[model samples]
Target: MPQMFRHRGFTGRIRRNYPMKKILKWTGIGVLAFAIVIIAALLIIPMFVDIQDYKPRLETMVSEKTGRDFAIGGDLELSLFPWAGISFSDLRLGNPPGYREKIFLSIESFDVRVKLLPLISKDIQVKRFVIEGPHLVLEKSSDGKGNWEEFGERREPEKKTATETQQEPRADMLPVKTLQVEECAIKNGTVAWIDDAAGTRNTLSELNLDLQNVSLDKPVDISLSANLDGRPLSMKGFLGPVGEKPGTGPLAFDLALSALDQLNLTVKGKVTDAATAPRFDAAFDLSPFSPRKLLDSFSVPFPVKTADPGVLNKIAAKGSITGSTEKISVNNGRLNMDDSAISFTVDAGEFQKPVLSFNMEVDSIDLDRYMPPPAEEAEAASKPKKKPDPEAGIDYGPLRKPVINGTVQIKNLTFSEARVSDLSIKISAKGGRYNIEPIELAAYEGTLKAGAILNVQKDTPSASAELNIMGMKINPLLQDVIDKDFLDGTLKAQMSIAFTGDEPNAIKKTLGGSGELLFEDGAVVGIDMAGMVRNVTASFGLSDKPGEKPRTDFSELIAPFTIKNGVVNTSGTTMKSPLLRLVVTGNANLVTETLDMRVEPKVVGTLKGQGDTKERSGLAVPILISGTFSEPKFKPDLKGIVTQGLKLPKTEDLKKALPGGDEIQKESLKDSAKDLLKGLPLKKK
Candidate 1:
């Protein structure tokens, strides 16, 4: 019974297996037949079908659809075997009616090959794509319409409602699942742009572009070279090793660019969520190059003529930059120019009411090198001064909107024949108020500490400053600044000043300040005090400073001053020297640049050290100084000599009446009498 049951089960299995095998065989046969028929159709259609015969209908259809004349001047070839491809020559597209040049675009030849099977998966794999000897023209008519304007109809774009715009992305967010190209190239393409109204014509010619390893999953190498308006330009780059979902994830790029063979640059970057909310981080490096040479390559003049021809040569920079829709940051930034280098970082955002911040450090720089060379003496003298333009005035409204903060430190800086060391500056601004705080620098054996504020909240801006200088050498400072060294001393000074308005002349007229200046162990060059004292009437003026450059040596000089409404007043400025004592009082008119001063001088017969305050034993000659600062006049106060209490007191009365009546005081009085009478041609009583 067991053997019989086994036999039946085996038969049952065979029965089921036979039908399954037969069904599989029939399915295979049907698939092979379909494939064979497709292959045959692909091979036979091109051979038997004369696609050119339908060119007129095809051209007519295209012309009607595109609203432009289209034609194929040469035979069209088609292939469908390993690569589905088409090749044609002498294709032309015409512009709309009324154009002088009817042909808008023309091509010598175009060929393309694409894999057909990939289309089923919504993917494109381009086997080969090539274009050769294509030409295009963009012409602007007198009415300002271009040949490339709207093709078939002037239809406004369909505007979506707010709700529609905010809708979720459709399933077909991307045009294709993936794109891959084995090779693509364009050669000898040209484009011409003509503007009839402007009477200008420009052309881009000899354009070549090539791409390799082009795939969504792999980096694509691209290169292009072209000539633009007779200037050469080239670009080579690699884009993407993109994520599986292109435009949703990271994409990387590296590019090198050059123009006129003079400027060379490289850029590397990455972008995330490129399609939705793109964020990018990039690095840019500029190779050492001459900016002057770059401009010259394009037959453009350098912006300014510099004192040193080589100043702007050899500049290089590298920086890392990152940006989003609302924010931008630059880090690891470095700039190199010849021997100078700077490191910096910057951040900016909120452009509507702009906010900007930066920190920078520079090793050394010479600004004078970049300044324009001095004009010729004769040319400068002959050039007419420009009249003030009433319309050219400051618009401080823009300053009121933005907020800015910055700090800069320079180890060494040189400009205008002056050198500074260890300079640091901090600045901030908001709502039309600007502040510069802790501005410190060292120059000419001196250190300066200063701060300033500018308020433009109102129509007329106002400014104020506080500055202090410590132990600075005046001779070298003046020599470097004005090429003059009429004063030699170590100076200490402090000032606080304020003014309104931005114009220099207006500011000077409105300036108000208080300051004190002290000079130690110095000489007033070009002045002779002893000669003035000896012959007061013969040379009453004593030239204040003779052209021969005689000088008066002083141990200490002090001046304290105040300014109001553009006038400076100094009530007591004192100078002590071995042979003279001088006191000066003056009001200097800053608006008119004039001086009104009184100087009292005393010649000492028995000189005392600067520290001693012995009685005055000398002839006093009061003098007046008046004129503009540029050409001051000095004269003795003859009226004062005739007026104030010079009625001679008897020698006994002078001794008893003077304060203290000390023996030294009495002797000084007697010596004054003897000297005045003996020195002058007067007889002694």
Candidate 2:
């Protein structure tokens, strides 16, 4: 038994120890040697492989599939261990038939490196990927087809049935579990659009891009610089932490972009569910810059001629936008144009027939500044004027689709010679009809409340308005509108009008409405009753009449009118005062802008403190006004005054009525009244 034990030796003890440590050590050494050999073979074998020998086969294979010539003109190099990589230079893809250019795409150099071990598990860890001097040309063939079209097998892709399409899963997540990239760059790449038929060529060239620290779980820094049609453009940004599953989660981005060295924009945003239903919230800022200089840099003329040359010189905007596939909203929006600033908010959806709601407010705006100046009369007359082109009827089809609800407020607004403050307009539109409800403004020491409706459902669009103006100073209003005043009053008016068409002449001809205007304690300039009575006495020396001004005063005046078929008729216009009572009836043609009116003044009221008895009677001295609105001609009705005064019972009674005038003096008053009716003739005195 002792000898048997001695022979067995340490075998029993080795079994007891289990020998696991030695087995593991030898297994590790073997693995290390095997790995070293494999790595060495990978590093050294490629040195003699001469991958160029396969280039012809690759080219032929690609050309056969694409139906285009392909070639590699430079050596291909490969590296293994440290990083697995391939690099090549001077690769070209030939254009399709009927193109003048021989090559459609050409790459000067390309290189990519990745971790090989991770690729075995289908995960890519890119170390360096670079493309240099890669140029792509998009050319239109003589047949109007693009050179880049109809590539690969000339067969349409299989169309999936509804069931199959619904069952197929979209590739929102990459095949790899993770992606890590250290460096990625595209250097001096270019794309060109050439159309020989149109004699045009546009190129985006010198495109250099770099991406830093790109990973599925970490933000990537990106910088890009390029020239678009000879204009410089650059962008730098941070994007993503795209997560392990791209297009499945939110992506955050912040970027700054500059174009043409004139405009700079910054964007910060987050996007979610990008592959299916993308939703985004973003803030955008555009730094102040000169729009004129930017357009000039592009060699493009300004789009509109403006009265003020300094306008549109600087413009900027900032806003926040939130949107999904179904809806979009803009909030906290600010826009600056020259000296004007506006803030607004907007929400929109239903892109096919858009529905929109918005609120906009402007601190101040001068519409006249943006409008083209009127031509001087001399210049307009000297130019050989062409007959105006016939105006085309407006197309209301587009208006029928959009639904709008909005309000606009302007603190100060100026148009032409008029200036208004606190202008507020609430607007709504749907189905071809639009309403501006309760438009309110302040002007000329008065408040104007108005509303308008525009209906485009008819072939000829129609519009109507209702207006109320209260406590207005007509002198200032007239002075602002015409730069002169012929009358003074405190005006109160209510007006309603309906009109068809969109031109001044058309509106005037089609206008129909009713309105009433009241003037309190006002004067009708250029017509003086007292002056006319005194003129006859002074001429005949019946009595030396004191000098009187050429004016007619009234305590209260009312002019009520109705308009139809472009003619304005007023039968109820009357004036009352302590001295005289006046009645006026008139027809004014809006289309022709002419006036035919009659006025009768009576000095029948008992002239208190005039040394006269209460036996006052009604008398009439008629006047006629007939002329264009711009130049009215006025004359006294001499036949009624002169011949009627002769029929009086006595010249003494007539003299008492005429403020110390005899029968001859009364006849002279008739002649002088004619001279008094003309505003210009009496103004010289």
Best by TM-score: 1
Task: Record all residue pairs in model 2 with backbone atoms less than 3 Å apart, i.e. clashing.
Answer: none
Residue 293 of model 2: what lDDT?
94
Model 1: per-residue Cα lDDT at residue 353: 75
Each model's lDDT comes to 0.81, 0.81
- List, residue by residue over 1-685, the lDDT tens digit for candidate 1: 8998999999999999999999999999999999999989989998999888888898898888879999999988889876789999999999998776899999999999998867779788898899999999999998999999878767789999989987957432765778888779999999999998887787889999999988778898989999988889899999987645778877899999997777789999999887878799999999888888877875678887777888887899999999988889999999998889999999999988789999999999998888767664346656886766778776878889989999999999988788899999999999999999989999988999999999999988999999999988988877786666567888999999999987767888899999999998988764566665655421233123345656678888999999998898999999888888888898988888777988877678655565666554534557676766655555456566568644333454333434355665444433332221132221211
Off by over 4 Å in 1: 1-107, 134-156, 161-178, 190-205, 226-237, 258-261, 376-393, 537-548, 602-605, 609-618, 646-685
* Superposition error at 611 for model 1 (Å): 13
Please provide TM-scores, in order, for all candidate models, with all chains considered together: 0.79, 0.77
TM-score of 2: 0.77
